[model samples]
Target: MSTSYDCSQPEPRREGLAAASGAVRAGQLVVFPTDTVYGIGCDAFSSEAVRALLAAKGRGASMPASVLVGSWHTIDGLVSSVPQAARDLIEAFWPGGLSLVLPHAPSLSWELGDTRGTVMLRMPLHPVALELLREVGPMAQSSANRSGSPPATSMEQARTQLGEAVPVYLDGGPSGDPVPSTIVDLTAVEPRILREGAVTAAQITEALGHDVPVAG
Candidate 1:
């Protein structure tokens, strides 16, 4: 069975972080709170860990995992291009509820499922997640639930669904947003919304000062 920690306590917060980061570096899965919902994540650089993450969710490679970075510097280190449109979006609503798909760098040797030549990235706002991300570097994470099931907004729900498959569960209580992030693909010729959630279409349009197209 996995250990669960309440992040509100200072001592447990430190202990939880140590356990979670260790699991990540060891290529193991851990559950933590995010801005949207609870997420299951591991070191994105570890293909084996990513496979385990997908398997734990009962998902296949066709569904790609999103990358969570601690900062913009981490994003720059992993990816090649951040178009003006992406920069605008990042500046307006980053470290919050937006997931941007940018061009992946050739030098990078890690994979995030069937991500193609692009990677979906975000800097989560939750302190527990941000702290873990800062410690673990880039992590490939997805909603903490079985595939085709509702995401776990609470740590209790996540534990029930995921069980001991994940070694560490950082209990940050309920996440900020019950909904997922708005996914925008900047690698496309025009910015496209892969999925609409926390960030509205109108807000994205206004943020970019132009018309943003929608694909889904």
Candidate 2:
């Protein structure tokens, strides 16, 4: 059976955090609210957990999953090198809805999917998510829904789709709008916008102090 917690309350929040942290460490999947939407996540270092996460969503490894962290400094250790534009963008939109795709440090021994030596990283602006992430380290996360379905905006919605595949659900209420984080590809010589969502192209340009190409 799966467990759900009402994170709006103090006692539940504490219990939920502990449960979710334990699940992640045990290479089990958990659902938590993010600034944009609810996400299904597992320990980033666990290939089995990541594979199960993708399988639960009826997804293939080609699409991969993004990694979420609790702090800005976490990127310094995950990626091979932090470019100036990455730092500027992080300072501007991190802890919000901006996902940056950067080259992963070659030494790390983890597989998210066919990431092509890269990983998309984000720091969500949600307390429950941040607390759990801080407690458990980086997590391989994707929107809490099956492929071709709408992303989950509430914990119940996530449970409806993911079911018992997710061992724990941290209910932080509705996750506001279902808009996803804007994805910016930082591996290129010039930054490129892969997907525009909560963040805008103009806002990204302003952050980098230069115009970036946006994929249509």
Candidate 3:
């Protein structure tokens, strides 16, 4: 059984985070909290690790996990032709609950399912997650739940669902917001909201200084 680390306690949390980060570097799955919800993830560059993430989530090949990075430079490396509006949105809402789908860099060796030559990226607003990214580089992550099930908002819930598939769990208590991140697609001519969650269309529009489209 995996020992859950309570993030409220500094010493244990640090020790657990180090162990979790180690598991990630070893190509093992780790369940951790994000600003919006709990996520299960593995090294994005490890095809073996990512396949394990998919398997743990009981997800199909067509459904891909998003990549999380620690900084804008990492996003820049994975993305190309970043729209000006994208830059504006990144400045305003990144390091929080916003996800951007941009043109995938052709050089990335690992696959994220059938991405259709595109990738969704997020810079989460959590110290633990950011530290993990800094330690392990980008990670391939999905909500810590089996496909078609409700996403877990607490460490206990995530543990129930992911079980031994995730060897380490970082218990950051309950995520303050149960809502998922807002997904914005910049590959289109006009930036579009593929899925709306915590971030609203009005907020995105204001960030872009223009009206953005919403996919129906």
Clashes of each: 0, 0, 0
TM-score of each: 0.97, 0.99, 0.97
lDDT of 3 by residue, 1-216 (tens): 777888889998898889899999999999998999999999998889989999999987699889999998788789767888788988999898999999888887878898998999999999888888898899999999988889899999999998998899999888875898999998988889999988999999998888888889
Q: Put down candidate 2 lDDT per residue, 22-78, tens digits, no spaces.
A: 999999999999999999999999999999999999999998999999999999999
Per-residue C-alpha lDDT of model 1 across residues 78-99, encoded as one tens digit per residue: 7787688988888888898899
Please give the RMSD to the true structure for each candidate, in Å: 1.1, 0.6, 1.0
Give the runs in model 3 whose Cα sits over 4 Å from its true position: none
The 0-to-1 C-alpha lDDT of every candidate, in the order given, reads 0.90, 0.96, 0.90
What TM-score does structure 2 among the candidates reach? 0.99
Output the better candidate (1/2) by TM-score. Answer: 2
